[model samples]
Target: MSTRQYGTFVVIGSGSGIGNHVAYTFAVKGFSHIIPLARNDWTYNRVCFFNAARIVLGGLLESVETIEENFETTNIALYIVAQWAIPRLRALSASSAAAKSSLLVTNSLLYANPIPQLFSLSLVKAAQCSLVMSLAKTFNSSGIHIALVTVGGAVAPEKLESKKYC
Candidate 1:
């Protein structure tokens, strides 16, 4: 016999890739209340590197400032979502004795072992992990499960392509 997971799921960063996959997977597994939160797309040109490593490497240090700004934007968005969703999550859990609400944060394994060029991402993921851990303890007795799922390695191109259908 298999155990079924019940209640509402609030998935952050459900815009693409792992986030998209996770949200779809939860729905396929019989989760009726699925909240997928996605961030607005941030666009930038690749003019800094036009088939030349030297030019890109030259601007590496400056990218950190840009990365930090992006991280702040994303962090604030996530905070807003969490603040708005918590009350609903509580209501859903309290309405049913068996219901269990969970907040699932999608993170990268680079959080633990920071990558050189992806330092900004690593910092954000690490902070998210910390937030999840703190929330887990804070809400332990409230029947709300907070979890951070870290994904590592290269995602197959097929999976990336399949995200469109998901």
Candidate 2:
């Protein structure tokens, strides 16, 4: 496969599972800026190339200088790190032409179907889908591309309260 050249993109929900894998993928190569934003403290390195790479961790910006100091705010390139935050981040980043951002998300297949066990998640997914459609329609002029990926059962969670879910 061929790789495209671009600057840093932020990874949300990046901790121990698929999110961490994607963050490490970006950190390995392609981009120089890899911002690993995770609510959890888990970090997984899938490749050796990221062994010595610099990964920045920040939850949110409290001050302008805070982001400047940590992520070099001069370059405003970014990407949403979470599945649900993907559209919001895409819109925020694409609100300006300088942001130069793109969104790549991994949504679950159940997002389209209804599951009794994951009923709450289904509602969230429905809302997320509507937001994605709205954002795509509103932000196409800002040079931001939205890539939707609905996938499931590929990478299971490593740490679970009960093994039955696995």
Which candidate achieves the best lDDT against the true structure? 1
lDDT of 1 by residue, 45-124 (tens): 00010010011121325566666664565455556656765666666667667565766666668668876676566666
TM-scores of the models, in the order given: 0.57, 0.38
Per-residue lDDT over 15-56 for candidate 2, one digit per residue giving the tens place of the 0 to 100 score: 667765665555444676767665532322211111111123
Indicate the worst ten consecutive residues by lDDT in candidate 1: 44-53
* Candidate 2 Cα misplacement greater than 4 A, ranges: 1-33, 36-100, 157-166
Clashing pairs in 2: 12-81
After superposition on all C-alphas, the RMSD of every candidate to the true structure, in Å, is 14.1, 16.4
Native-to-model Cα distance after best TM-score fit, residue 6 in candidate 1, in Å:
28
Score candidate 1 by lDDT. Answer: 0.57
Give the C-alpha miss distance for residue 82 in model 1, angstroms. 1.0
